[model samples]
Target: MEISEMNLFGREHIKVFKNRPKAITEILSDGVQQFGEKVAVATEEHELTYKELDDLSSIAAANLQQAGIEKGDRVAAVIGNRHEFPIMVFACSKIGAIMVPINVKLAMEEIEYILGHSKPKVIIVEQEFTKKVRQAAEASGSLEAGSRLFEIEGENTFSSLLEQNAELTEAAISEEDGAFILYTSGTTGRPKGAVLSHINVIHSVMNYKYVFQTDDTMKTLIAVPMFHVTGLVGQLLHVLYVGGTVYSMKRYQNEAYIERILKDQINFLFNVPTIFIMMSTSEKFQNHSFDFVKKVAFGGSPIYQQTFNMLKQAFPNAQLHNAYGSTETTSPATLMPVSYPEAKVTSVGRPVAVADIKIMDSEGNECEPGESGELYIKGPMVVKEYWDNPEANLSSFTDGYWHSGDLGIMDDEGYIYIRDRKKDMINRAGEKIFSIEVEDVLKSHPDVVEAAVIGIPDPVFGEKVKAFVVGPSLDPDDFSMLKEHCRKSLAKFKVPEEFEIIESLPRNASGKILKNTLKQVGGEKNA
Candidate 1:
């Protein structure tokens, strides 16, 4: 894995992997050449070997071409964690079309905005989501000009696209061409599409392979949504690059997931810490044998020490890794090393081989080693710019570095530790408090399953800390004990003045806790 420097898109000395697959489609072709008969992707109902994946995607691409999809056309998929998702990925890549994967859980307004913004030439949706997609398309006026719609399981289905008899013509696709337009969760404002080029995705997958030391023997389960970079680029594409097998889960269920792991002999696991928390606390998970698992990766949110300890116990033989990245970075900018000192457990490890990170203060000066600041990442994996928002592009990208909008600290050893999001950082009477620190401390309590901390408006202090906890029913005694637990670990001022118990935390499609949704909840004090 040699690296060479190239001046790409006005950025000088950008490092890229040499002699890699030039396009996303080439990944599948290489797999087909080496692991042709082996299953490339599978679900409960359907499976496709490398050869079938290549051949069927060719047919699908031909059908798309026949339906007038040409080079650089946008093909949006409002689908879920199905086999068809991966097929559509290759189909678009093969025909030089850009794939726009919309999170199925998004509201109609959000979906409409994405449809209108991206202006996809064709939208392939799942059966359950077709009506919503239709309404969104209509509202967005995307269907007025004849944007083709194909359902995954019904009439005018995507499966039929693979059966159509149309000659596939080769399109001139380049490594730098946009391969996917991934929309960020619109927590602060309207979602912006992060345009990931073919090289961005390929390099991300390569980084995972390099850091994880994974190979063709990998049997990974797609426990997360395929639309997400973690599942798509991190698990699916990474495994495919190594000529490994991928098992797709239509929907993630804890018990069913454990069964699938045992049934399929899944050896590699990648998911959010929340999923691992639930699985680690499950009785079924405790009874199962996970000795076959080689590596386990978790990210998207902070993990309490209790959860990390539980994961270690559950997957005794597996190496646990903490990853940190965003859609702008494709998937991983930083990955935990296989082994490190216990003191580095809280750190997100160093940046990937091709990634360069800078911690800059508010005044734009680079921060000292231990000082907290914004994390800016530049790498082959990082997307060059947002889809069509010039304002966002100008503000977000500076000299090829994508502003991560995340507050972090890099130690003298180069291990990066995420403090909080820049906007999510709480200023309490001029005292700074990172929500993740309080949330992690709260989750350390045995009775607390999960916790989220937010800054509530206050007259005295600029803002006061409030916590939302999802845990056992708390009596007066239990509440006091929980408060005591937090007081012992956190500063008195950092402890939540109010605590609310809820059934579960609201999350976006990516399994990130929606603090914005929690902020809208009335200030009713229960705990």
Candidate 2:
């Protein structure tokens, strides 16, 4: 089947199609119609097919109705990446209830902010987190006994709700209706919420199938957190669209991921570069034959060459795809072609089918080859706006295009090469510096384990480049050794003015650098 281009070649053209958005509910129903008995999800003890998933979510939907959840109302679920997540997400989508999947890793204060923002009618949680949920509820003054709490781990309690309501009410949702509010794991400022419409969800699902050539025979190993758009929209939602089975993991256990790939005969796998680095570096991942995994894709961060070398030696038969996307873009706008005889180890490829992406400089002017710039995406997949965040919406979207703050450059062939963000850049002594550029140059050194660069206050200079480095028992004040290494590679001003040797860099749960904290760790610096 031949495909028409999305209007990426023309200027100011947004593209067409997806007018009749079979809402998320309609998409799931279609999956059931085509592959009713095909397995849709599996855990250690429980398994379900398309038919079973539909029936189970229908029961949950009916229970939500009984609990007085109205259409277009927001609902919170305190759950992990287990099978329950997909079930609840689908149920909420079917009922036009905005699904707010709370990240289990956030602080109580962070969790409360989301609760206050959406003001969910009820909180669906498991027994494992009952105490935390109860505490949050009490603090929010939503401690009324009438409020519904659907506990998945409570056997008798959940069973009773299922028995009472086995039918689901169809939602009156338009293509423009909001389906989810995925809060960004913001490393710098407050977490901004991205509002995804029904059309955005459908658009991503269709794009996944179209770009990846997914089919019903495909089986996926989902290890990324379901709260993020990549796991929720790119992996789970796309699998449902293609009628594929899923082997779900609560967390990224290296052994479990390798075990599932070997034992379950999984075809496609989705995760971040961190997970891949862990897997490829682990000795256990080498013990198995992952020949069954046809497509192993990663996003969230740039992957290094060492890890790719390890994967090639371990699973040479598996094809590795580097994906570039984010929550606001509904996950994937670029489906990087698999690395060749040897992986390129860089270059995150061109835009996927159904996407229009370009790399623009700081002034919104298009960047030519070899020039780094911000990446912008415009298509059906881009979210309508941030949830009730007028300030963020005004700053993020420009003339129907979503400005992905990520910095990159497009080559002559249209392949994009990502650099550090413009905001993540540091200015020291009137000289510009990119943290990733400094970190990359530092990591290339034999002794360095990790490196993060930031600017610290200076009396003479406006700000000085300070590096927080992690290495195997090294001294930061060894200017003779460290400066020599930098002198061989980096420019004079880009080299760190001071260095602080630490065991590790402070990072958020999403594996992003907490540069603010690093900057605050300033005192009498050494170099």
Most accurate candidate by lDDT = 1
Q: What is the Å distance of residue 450 in model 2 from its true position?
A: 3.8
Q: lDDT scores for all predictions?
A: 0.89, 0.75
Winning model by TM-score? 1
| Ten contiguous residues with the weakest lDDT in model 1 | 518-527
Write candidate 1's Cα lDDT for 405-427 as tens digits: 99999999999999999988889
Q: What lDDT does candidate 1 reach at residue 497?
A: 84
Candidate 1: clashing pairs of residues = none
lDDT accuracy of residue 489 in candidate 2: 84
Determine the C-alpha RMSD for candidate 2 after optimal superposition of all C-alphas.
Answer: 3.5
